[model samples]
Target: MQKLTINLALITPLIFVVMYIIPLGLRDLWSPDEIRYAEIAREMVSSGNWTVPTFNGLRYFEKPVMGHWMNAVSQLLFGENNFSVRAASVFSSAGSALCLWLLVERFITRQMAWISTSIFISLFMVAAIGTYSVLDSMFSLWLTAAFSAFFFAFTADNSAGRYKNYGLAGLFCGLAFLTKGFLALLLPVIVVFPFLLWQKQFTSILRWGWWVIAIALLVCLPWGVAIHLAEPDFWFYFFWVEHIQRFAATNAQHSEPFWYYFAYLPLAILPWLFVAPTAIRHLGKHLNLPLIRYALLWAVIPILFFSLARGKIVTYILPSMVPLAILLAVGLSSAYQKQTRGFKWGSVVNAIVMALIASAFLILYYLGYLPLEQGEHYRPWLAFTAFSFWALFACLAIRTTTLEAKICCYSMMPVGLFLFFWASIPNLSINSKMPAAFIEELKPYVTEKTILLADHPSTMSALNWYLQRNDVYLLNSKGELEYGLSYPDAADRFITQQQLAEFIKTKQNNSTLLIFMRGSALPETQLPGISKRFQRGRFSAYYFAKDTSHD
Candidate 1:
């Protein structure tokens, strides 16, 4: 057991280095969440205000400051670069891998832990959250740490200091809540409840439950109370509106069908998705192994809960990966036990499934389902093929009922390493519009005092962050007409088209630049002397002349 623990310990660091450290600087920071979080950290660092996070001088209170604080700490230590931004996740994911190793090692075997950890390292969703600079990675990290702490507390001997362990678990849960929000709290309830019920230890479970809640609140209370005192509106919106409404009822247009997450589950839980049924079959029998049963509850509850929710994103179901990895490990070990009869067929099934998947995508591409030139076409196919080949190779390499099965399963390490760097990471870093392709053209036109005006107030929060400048303006014409009219400094601040014309007439005494949306017609008489620069995509910037700047 000790030797197995030592072996699995070696795998986590190796996987971390291959997935994170090697490709540290290959890509530029992109938009939507990446730059938004980066900039929030940047702002937090600059303003010395950790309570309320602002973006481009707007009241941006969408998430807590834990992720930004993480980036800030990394930036302080490592210096602000792509790697620095992602460093928090590096430690988080590595720690999560360790948790997986220990959990499996304690209840099952070291072999299952090692194989499961290897498979987890390659899981597309896991790689996506852990390697990239995002909220999910940090969230995943805290969640795993908390869950691991909780598991150890429950199973530790009386001599092992159970209270302290549970307390530490609560602390981790608090950190997890701060990292994202209520999802961290919601996760443990759904994951741990089933196991307690199954064990028929409901009384003992309730006895220890209050301490956990107290510890969680103790860790989380300072931030919660402080935020509520500072801004009740923020507390309400963040906790209730954003957290609760988002899942309960679809707010922010984030609504999806109930089956949306279920449909995406195969991709999120890939490779392991097929083995989940087997794990389910053995769940009742595994009650003797607390850790394995804990894993079953951990994996199953989250999928069931989130799948039934109105809100769905690929990331919403990520917490399930932890238990899923364990179940897959158990499944692999079971398969190894059954390997003696005429070469196990699961490898062949994996290969055929992958080949079929690849062929399906290829057929779709040819049938106009996928655009040949744009969208991620060939890479996903490559990724699937790589996954299939590795699974097949691992299955074939191991002799039935021997240690070779354990050794060969470690092949998932390389397979995961491949899909992340070659497939998932690149797809997110490069293919998404989050990374600006027009920065080269747009940079030259922007000067130190350049003011970017957008028809939509929140048009490109990421772009504003990428430029590292907050001198952007928004024309409040959508629904803030009366609210906008109240601002006394109309000439220099954001205004409506009529206000824009009036401001230009009064203030445009020199050459001024204006970048506005495509099809937004400028007044024929206003800004007439502005020299027209060529339009780029959806934006056109003009050099305005003083006299013709107004109607």
Candidate 2:
């Protein structure tokens, strides 16, 4: 036991360092989502208003305030960089992995617990999303912790202990709700209620279910009530437009086919992808067990629920990872015990797949299918990493005799992924849609006195973050920002093309006016004396000097 404790102490930090910590601040915040969330948190911290979330000085209410609040706190402590902004998610993800270890340890062997937790963290989607500055990882963490706590509470032999566990479950559920809203509560209900019915625990559920609901509401009510009191229509907008309309209407523009998530699930858990079918079969053989039954329901119900919803995205199915990891751990454990042929063949197949992908990239580069400049820059690193993974897996396939060794081999996959990501960092920065350098070039022209105008602000969300100021004028734009702009205080920030032209013509001689628009949207006739100053990617910036003559 002492040795086990020491091993865990050493392993925990090691996992964190490899999975979350070392990669911190290595990449720029990607556009559209990462930058938007980071900037909102920045605005929150700068404005000293925590109740209502704002993006680019507009009252943004697309998401709940918990993520923004956590991010603001991170920035306060870490001084506002990519690492600081993403720190909340990184810690939350690590916390979730720890919780998974503890939860599994309660019901299974400690070795199995460690294996399950490792598998959970190693999955491609889990590691990738956890490192990014997004709310989904935090939400998934809270939801998984809540479910795990509830499972413990529900399965407890003692009545008093069961109620206490219910309280913890409620608290975590409430935290989850704060992270992402009603879906948190909805998912738990969908997962747990069916398990209760299947177990015929009607009396037990009837006795404690209301307590769970009451505690969750108690924990969640303060923020909900506060937001409602501050904005009378907040509840309507949050529940109706953000939740109901988002799910029911495609007009929100996030439309994808119903099969999107189904197709994505296999890839999301890649490298372990070949083992999934065998895991499912193993799960079917053990369905009679209460824990296995719960795992099955936990995994399947969310996929079906999200598949039925009109709106879909890749991360919506993150909650399923918990149960999927549990099932995979069980399957792998059994494979080790029984020397299953499936495990052996699956490892071989994974190796072949890796080799094929790596060879294809090398072939493409040689044949000129890839850009010669970038390809030449990336080829050596890509070749080394890919071939290395292929060789490692191939060796394990050919030489490994024990299932224990095979499971150990799987751990290297995530390490290889991070190494590849680290190697590709330079290329990713160059190819990123966000104009980090371009914005840096515009810094001299942007000042407190400068009048900045964006032809369509919605398309260039990264500008809000890089510019670090929200006083820019928008000309002819409406989308996600529409909600924030609809409020009376933000009306003046929006201007028409004619209004922008007039402002340019009549601006004070001491003040400079800059216009940023898409390359295609640049007017055929330059605005009198406005001269194009910078052009990068799809965006172009024009400078209107105070003393320049009109055309």
Clashes of each: 4, 0
Which ten residues in a row are the worst by lDDT in model 1? 478-487
TM-score of 2: 0.92
Segments of candidate 2 deviating more than 4 angstroms: 1-13, 250-252, 372-376, 383-387, 422-432, 455-460, 508-510, 517-519, 524-526, 547-551
lDDT of each: 0.63, 0.75
- What would you estimate as the lDDT of candidate 1? 0.63
Best by TM-score: 2
Q: What is the lDDT of residue 542 in candidate 2?
A: 83
Question: TM-score of each candidate?
Answer: 0.80, 0.92
1-551 per-residue lDDT for model 2 (tens digits): 11122243355457567768777787667766777788888888888888888777887778888888888999999987878978998988887887788877887778778778767877778877888888988898888888888888888999788888898888989988888899988998898889999988857767888888888999889989988888888778788888998788867447777798989988778657887777666665677777777878888899999887887888888888878888898887776576677776787788777777767766776676654353446754565575567447645744566544455556556666664555554443443355566677888877778777776654345567777777777777755788878989999888877776666777635678777765446564746666557776566788876654553
